[model samples]
Target: MDAGTRNRLRARLVSLRDELLTQGSMNIPPARTDVVSTPDDDEAPLTHMTQAIASNRNRERADRLEQIRDALALVDEDPEQFGLCEVCEEPIKPRRLELMPWVVLCVACQEKHEHEHRSPGSRKHLGDFQ
Candidate 1:
């Protein structure tokens, strides 16, 4: 990739890192226990469920942030490897990079990777329910 394009991608990744950090800092405070527990004490479970969902969402974002940081490191350490597919060692399509700057695989390699990584039974059962 050109120096200009690399810089642009780095800037975008930095922006994304900031956005993820800002969004992931949110939390739902625990339910209060001042009032006596009652049969209708549904607030506790509902609050717990809400907190679980938020935790999961934040975790996903955290994972993505970590990936972005790693990509930045790769770009810094080896500029030549920045746009090459990890699996094929070939230049990834510029259009694919535009859509997913964090991707480490080209389209063909990604499809093969996904197929191998997925559960065989899941794909074999596509029409069983019908």
Candidate 2:
């Protein structure tokens, strides 16, 4: 990649790292809470279920934030490596990097990976999904 492009990607990586840190910090507090107390009433069950769902979502977000942080660290250590796909060892497209600075996979490898590992009930529509 050109020097200018590398500089732009580095700036974006730094921004993404900061955002991930902020989000991960926010998720940590709620994640430490004790499980909701079991209740005899139906309303309590619904509330508990909602809370559980929220907790799961937070956990997932936190995990993603960690991945983003790691990716940023990799970029800082060796910006050249950021241009390669983590899974297939192929060069990532410049446009892809421009669009998602933290991405670690090329378009073809990413699509293949997602196709093989995506959940059964996951959204299949391109527009509705990432």
Candidate 3:
């Protein structure tokens, strides 16, 4: 990638990192201290479900933040390889980077990774045989 594009991407990554941190801080649900265990508590299940969902959201957010940080570090450590895919060592499309600056794989490699990591119970389609 050219200097201008690399600079632009770095700026974008910084902006995105800042935005994610802000969102993470703002989205944290306050700690609940009013819940008491009761044999007939009807809302217990709902409360547990809500906590699980929020925990997942926080985990996802943290993972994305880590990716962005890694991308920024790579940009600084090795500019020549910044836009290259980690799995295939091919240059990722500029459009893809524009949309997701933190991505480390090209679209094809990403698809393969997802396919390989899919749950065992997932339906096998025609493409799975490939």
Candidate 4:
């Protein structure tokens, strides 16, 4: 890619990474509250469960933010590697790069990777799932 295009992609990736970080940091731990009713109360249990679920989701978001940061770092370190498939070492399509500047796989290699590594019991029947 040209220098201008690479610069644009880098800027985009950096902005995305910053946004993810900001959003992830905002997902703080759920506050604990005193239960006024019996422990067996439906609302209390449901509220606690919902808070737990939100905590888990926040953790996952933090992990994803880290991944995005790493991807941005890679792009900064080597622009040439930005649009190349990590699995097949092929040039990723420009449109794909435009859509996801930090992607590390070409379309074909991404498809293969998804098919081969998808979780067990996951449906893989469609060709366009990816």
lDDT of 3 by residue, 1-130 (tens): 9999999999999999999888863243434555774533676667667777888888888899999999999999999999999999999989889989999998889778877888988765434533
lDDT of 3: 0.84
Per-residue C-alpha lDDT of model 2 across residues 1-130, encoded as one tens digit per residue: 7768878887887777677667553222332245785454756666666777778877876777776677777767887786789888888888777777768887777777777898998756433334
The lDDT values for all models are 0.78, 0.71, 0.84, 0.72
Clashing pairs for predicted structure model 2, backbone only:
none
Rank the models by lDDT, top first. Answer: 3, 1, 4, 2
Query: Could you tell me how far off, in angstroms, the CA of residue 4 lies in candidate 2 after the best superposition?
Result: 2.0
lDDT of 1 by residue, 24-101 (tens): 655756566456755347677888887888788778888888888988898899988998999899998887777667
TM-score of 4: 0.73
Which pairs, if any, clash in model 4?
none
TM-scores of the models, in the given order? 0.75, 0.67, 0.82, 0.73
Cα misplacement distance, residue 13 of candidate 3 (Å): 0.7
RMSD of 1: 5.1
For TM-score, candidate 1 versus 2, the one ahead is: 1
Q: Least lDDT summed over 10 consecutive residues: which range in candidate 1?
A: 121-130
Best-to-worst ranking by TM-score? 3, 1, 4, 2
